[model samples]
Target: MATLQIDADNFQPTITNNATVIVDFWAPWCAPCRGFAPTFEAAAEKNPGIVFAKVNTEEQQEIATAFNIRSIPTLMIFRDQIVIYSEAGALVPAAFDQLIEQAMALDMDQVRLEIAGQQASS
Candidate 1:
C-alpha cells in the first residue's frame, strides 16, 4: 500500500487504529527528507500489511509538535495505539526491514502492561 499523508485532521484516528503504523515526520525543505521519501515509499510497497504514513512538519506543525519532533526525517513505529520505536535520521532499507520484523514480533500484552505500569507509577 502507498503511504498515507498524516495531518492534524487524521493523526489521532490513524494511529489509534489497530495496525502497525510507520509514521515519517518530515518537511519539504529538508534535503534528507526528500532523499528518504522514496525509500519510505519503497518500504511501504514491500510491506502491504503495514500502514506507512507521513506527516509534513511544515504543513502540520501541531502534529509534529505533539510528537516533539526535533529533527526532520524522524521515523516512529506504532502498534495497538502505542509507540514502539522512535528515532531521528533516515533508516537504510535493511534497518527499516529489521524494524518491521522486530515490531511484528512484540508481545503487545506485555507492551500494554508496561505502559500501564509506567502510568500507575507516575
Candidate 2:
C-alpha cells in the first residue's frame, strides 16, 4: 500500500477509523523530510495492514498546529485511536521498522487501562 496524502479534512476520520496508522508530518522543502520519504514509503508497502498517511505541514498548517508539530518529519503512530508514539526527527530504516514492530506488539487493553488510571488519578 502506498502512503495516503492526508489533509485537515480527512485526518481525524482517518485516524479514528484505522486500527493502526503511521502518520508522517512533513514539508517539501525540508531536506530530511525528503530523505525520509522513501523509508516511509517502503514501510507502507511492506506493511499493507497498517495505514500509512502523510500530512504536508506546509499545506496543512491547521493539522500541524493541532498536533503542535514544531519540527518537520515528525512521525506519529496511532493505534486504537490513541497516540502510541510521537517523535520529531527522521529515523533510520532499522529503527523505524523496530518502532512499527513495537507498536504492533502493544497490548492495547493494558494501554487503555493505564490511560484510564491516569485520568482517574488526575
Q: Which predicted model would earn the best lDDT? A: 2
Candidate 1: residue 109 Cα off by (Å)? 0.6
| Model 2 residue 56 distance off true place after TM-score fit, in angstroms | 0.4
**Candidate 1 residue-wise lDDT, 12-81, digit = tens:** 8998874789999999899999988998999999999999999999999988888999998999999988
Global CA lDDT computed for model 2: 0.96
Which ten residues in a row are the worst by lDDT in model 2?
A: 8-17
Error of 2 at 84 (Å): 0.5
RMSD of each: 1.1, 0.5
Candidate 2 root-mean-square deviation in Å: 0.5
TM-scores, each model vs. reference: 0.94, 0.98
Candidate 1 residue spans exceeding 4 A from truth: none
Q: RMSD to the native, candidate 1?
A: 1.1
Model 1 vs. true fold: TM: 0.94
